[model samples]
Target: MSGVKMNNVIKQYGEIQVIHGIDLQIKDGEFCVFVGPSGCGKSTLLRMVAGLEETTSGQMTIGTRDVTTMDPSERGVAMVFQTYALYPHMTVKENMGFGLKMNGHPKSAIEAKVAEASGILKLDEYLDRKPAALSGGQRQRVSIGRAIVRGPEVFLFDEPLSNLDAELRVEMRVEIARLHKEIGATMIYVTHDQVEAMTLADKIVVLRLGRIEQVGSPLDLYRDPDNKFVAGFIGSPAMNFLDATSGEDGVTIQALKMTAPNPIGKTSKAVTAGLRPEHLEIDPAGDALRVDLVETLGGVSFAYLVSDTGEKIVIEERGDEPVSEGQRVGLKFDAKRLYLFDAETEQRLRA
Candidate 1:
């Protein structure tokens, strides 16, 4: 296994520079995930690491070897793309062992490696089946198995779960996590799905507009984001932003008619208060909020409300009786759980 490192890396397509200078590190055997919205350059950065895209400037290294200019085969990395890229005429065994065969490995050695990968991915039952006969999940597993047979030092996944169905995506996430745990290889996965990043990543690298917003453990990013963008992008239903202004004693939220203590020192600048959906509670005597809609997902519910100031907020509901649509209700904000950001800069105001 080998760690990957980039020092002020930049990528450009003639005059259009899609990737700005980026510096990052992935520890050996770490399951690192790159997550961001579409056109955020996460895939471009991943492709750069895989040697599929060239680095316009700066340095990149795999382990102790500089691979910025090296060929894809020399980078010691195996990539599993979004597509399965399986051959319809080839059986699972053949597909898995094809790479090794092309690389001129002995037939017996190829068989041994294929057997090992198949065992790891539970593809032994489907080895004799062709790609047309396998399910989407199984075909994806075959694709992953093909990468495993190469025994590369680093594994790169570019939205490998994007093609799978919801259920299959969940299953594949578990399987990939298990595979990482069992093999202990350095792996970098790229996906726009925050859930996947939160579930599978040992370290999550949140990117925005070709620049890294923040890099930390999943919970660290979720609970302690550096800015509004990071905070909003890291969580489901996202963190709610409320218009507020700094006051002498505390920050006053006009929308909720609440004042949360300013943990940071007093500031004259306008502020935006962030509250996660789970942190807000329904209170009969609190600020009145009109429910626009309610989404009940079994154990938990989400109440979409329009505050008095016309700001939209989502509150997670856990009670047996959920707040209904078009209902007027009061909301209580947990001052301790509140997040404060500078309205102009959108940067967190830390205590």
Candidate 2:
């Protein structure tokens, strides 16, 4: 295992710069994931680390080696791409051991390495099968096994499970987490899927439009988001945003009244209020809303509603009685659960 360091990394294409200055330190054996929307320069940064793309200006070091200008093969890294790039005609074992053979390892050493990787991946039963005959999940494992045989210092995965079905994706996600634990290798993954980043990462690096937003553990980011974007992007069903304004001694939502923690200053203006769906309760003593749709998912129910001011919100309610559409209901948000942010900067306000 090895640590990765990026010092003032920057990337550009001609005169148009895509990635701004970025500095990060990924510890040895840590599973770090970069997550963001499309065109956020996440993949571009990952490529720079893997030596697949050159850094326009910065220093990249792996372990104790300065590999900023090293070739991809000499960077001591292996990358597993979104598309399972397997040879159509090669058997699983052949594909896994191909890198060793090309590097002039003896036949016995190559065979031993392939056997070991196949065992770890549980591909022993399907080693004779070609890519066409294997399932999508199996093919992805073969891709990972190929990277493992090289014994790279770092492992890079770029949306490795996006092509799988929902259930298969979940299964493969668990498999990847287990593999990381078993191998104890430094791995960096990039994905747009928040679920993948939340479940598989020890630390998540949130990026937006060529610059990093924040870096922290999944739960830390969830419990205390630095801004509205991080809060909305990290959670499922997304956090609800409501326009709020501060009065002489309190804060008020559209048509729904709320109290502030303290007196609001003119400069400490409130613009947006955020709350997660799970924090809302259908209490009789709360603000009233009209239900638009209720989606029952067996274990829990999601109530989609519209406030009197026309703002949409979702509340999680696990109950026996089903809520129907167009039904008027009251909602109580846990006061301690609310988040306030600046409307212009989208930055979170201190509680």
Candidate whose lDDT is highest = 1
lDDT of 2 by residue, 158-194 (tens): 9999999999999999999999999999999999999
Model 1, span 132-231: residue lDDT tens: 9999999999999999999999999999999899999999999999999999999999999999999999999999999999999999999999999999
lDDT of each: 0.93, 0.89
TM-score of candidate 1 versus the correct structure, residues matched by position: 0.98
Off by over 4 Å in 1: none
What is the Å distance of residue 241 in model 2 from its true position? 0.7
Candidate 2 structure lDDT:
0.89
Error of 2 at 150 (Å): 0.5
Question: Lowest summed lDDT over 10 consecutive residues: which window, candidate 2?
Answer: 259-268
Off by over 4 Å in 2: 255-257, 260-268, 284-287
TM-score of each prediction: 0.98, 0.96
Clashes of each: 0, 0
